[model samples]
Target: MSEVPAYLREGYITPDELFRKIPKPSEERLRARPVAVPECPQEIPCAPCREICPTNAISMPTPNDLPVVDYEKCIGCSLCVQICPGLAFFMVHYVGDKARITMPHELLPLPERGEEVVLLNRIGEPVGKGKVLTVVPREKTKGDTPIIIVEVPIELAWDVRAIKVVRE
Candidate 1:
C-alpha cells in the first residue's frame, strides 16, 4: 500500500486524512446537535475565534495554533462563524432528513431562503444541489458577517460547505 500523498490538487491534505486529523465531537452523541467545525489545517498565527468566543469554547495554546473547539462548552451560537477572518468556521446541524450548514457569506447578493443553489466542495467541485433554508444578513450577525443556511442531504453534510446561488 502507498502512503498518502503529501499534497492534493488544492495543496493540502486529503479529505480522509483531514477527517482523521480533526476531532469530531458531535458524532459521540446520538441526538441531533449543532457543532462548529474549523477547516483551518495550517499553523497560522491567528486567534480571533478564541478571543471572540463568549463561552470560551475554543482553545488556542499558541498564536500559531489553529482553533480547537471544545464541543462540550460550545453553545452553537455561531459567533466564531462570523468572527473567523479566514472564513473557515462552519456550524453543522444534523437533523432528521437534512443537514443545516451555516457558512460565512462575504460575496454580494446574499442567498435567501427557499432559493436553490449549487453545493460546492473545498476544491470548487459541484457536489450536488441544495435549497437555501435560511439567510442571516450582516445586520443580524454578531460580527456583521452575513451567513446562509442551506439544507442538503444528510450524507453530504460534511462534503458540502459553500453554495453557488444563481444571480440574474
Candidate 2:
C-alpha cells in the first residue's frame, strides 16, 4: 500500500479516503441486502447521487465534497447508480455464496439474462467469469443508462466493477 493507487495519483479519491468518508457496514448489513458503494472518490462538484437517494442514504456536506452513504438507510435501489454522471455508484448484494453486482452498462449491445460474461476490474482487465442475473433497460434509468446485474464469486464482489461481453 506504499505506492499511491491510480485513483489518487490521477486526482480521484483514494480507497482509504473513501473508507473514512463513509461508515463501515457490518457483515449482517452487507449479507442481508444491497448497498450502494460510491467509487467516486474525487472532490468534484457533484451531488446527483445525494439528491436522488429516496432513503436519503447519500449525502454531501458541500458542493465539492465526496458523496457518503449511510448503509443503514440505503434501500438497495439503483437510482443513484443510474443517475451517476461518472458511473461510479454500484449496488452490491451478497447472497449465500455469491455476490450480485448492479452496474451501469452503456455498451452498444447488451448481454442477455443468464448469459455468461467476463468479469472486469476497475481498469477493465478481465478477472473472471460471471452470470448475468438481470438487465435493466435504458428507459428505466433516470439518466438513460442501462444497468446490468451480474452474479460472481463472493470474493470478487469488491474487485469486480464492470463486465465484458464475449461475443462470438
Candidate 3:
C-alpha cells in the first residue's frame, strides 16, 4: 500500500470534506432541479470557480455572494473542482447511459488506478458500485486532493454522487 500523504496523515481537513458538511441548496430555490451545484453559504472571498470556468458558466459578479453556475453551459469538465480554493466543486455527468461523478479526494493511500470502489450519494448514502477511472494529482490542485472519477450504473448515476474506497 502507498503511504498516506503527510497532510492526510497529519489530520488536516480537506476542502471537500468541509464543503460536504454544508447544507445543499433547497430544491425550491433551484431553477434547474436534479443537477447538483455548489451553493456556497459562507461569505468567503474565493472565486476560483468563477474565474476557472471555461464557458463562463460560473458567475460571481461580486465577491461576497455565492457563486452561481449556469448548468446549461457548464461542460462538467471539473475545472472548477481543480481550481476552487474551498474544494467545493463537483461534477456529475449522466452520459452514455451511466452516471459518473467527479469529486476532490485528498486521502493518502489513494485508490489504485482503475480500482473498484463503492459510491456514496450526496447524502453520504451507499447507492452503488463504481470504478476509478482517473486520479488527477496536479500541482495547481494543491496536490492535497486527488480528482476521483467514478463510474456507476446509469440508473443510479445521478443518485450516486460521491464515493468511498472499499477497505479490505
Candidate 4:
C-alpha cells in the first residue's frame, strides 16, 4: 500500500481544517457572483501553477504564498494540473456560448472523450449533463495527471464544477 503523507497519517492535516484556518469572504459578498478569475486565499508553498502557465499569467514571488493568476492573459491550457501537487488548479472558459471547464480527474475507469456524464456542483451535488470534450490520460500528461475537459451550458457553467459518468 502507498504510504500516507506524514501530515495525513499523523491526523495533522485535512482539507476542511486548512480551509477553516483561512480567512473567508463575508456572507453578503459570498452571495454575489464570483469573478471569472478567483483569488487564492492562503500563503501555501506552491509555485507549480505559476511555472506551468504557458502565457505567464500566474506569478508567485514567494514559495509559501498563493500565486496570482491574470485571467485576461490566461489561455486555459490546463498545464497547471500536471504540476500542482494539491491538484488545486482548474480552467474556466465562459466565452463559447457554453462554458468549458477543464479539471484534474484522478479516478478509476476513466471516461472517454465525447461521453455524456452528469455534471456536479461544488458541493458534490448533481446538476446536469455535460459532454466530455477531452480526456488527457496520464501518459499524455506530464505525470500521473488525467485532465478531463467538459462542456456545459453557459448558465450552469459556474454551478457545474465536476462530472460523474453514468454507468450504462
Candidate 1, RMSD to the unseen true structure: 3.1
The TM-score ranking, best first, is: 2, 1, 4, 3
Clash pairs, candidate 1, are none
Q: Which candidate has the highest lDDT of all?
A: 2
Clash pairs, model 2 backbone: 13-41
Error of 3 at 8 (Å): 26
**Best candidate, TM-score:** 2
Please write out the lDDT profile of model 3 over residues 30-88, one tens digit for every residue.
Answer: 22322336635556777877776788877776877677776666666677787666656
Q: Model 4 TM-score? A: 0.71
RMSD score of candidate 2 (Å): 2.9
lDDT of 1 at 67: 79
Error of 2 at 95 (Å): 0.3
TM-score of 2: 0.90
C-alpha-based local distance difference test score of model 2: 0.86
* Candidates' C-alpha lDDT: 0.80, 0.86, 0.64, 0.65
> Is candidate 1 or 4 superior in lDDT?
1
Poorest 10 consecutive residues by lDDT, candidate 3: 26-35
Model 4: per-residue lDDT, tens digit, 1-168?
997554455533333443454333333332332212322345677676777677887766788876666555655556776667665666666544676777778776688998999898765789888899989988998757788888888778556756897786
Cα RMSD, model 4: 7.6
Ranked by TM-score, the better of candidates 1 and 3 is 1
Clashes of each: 0, 1, 1, 0
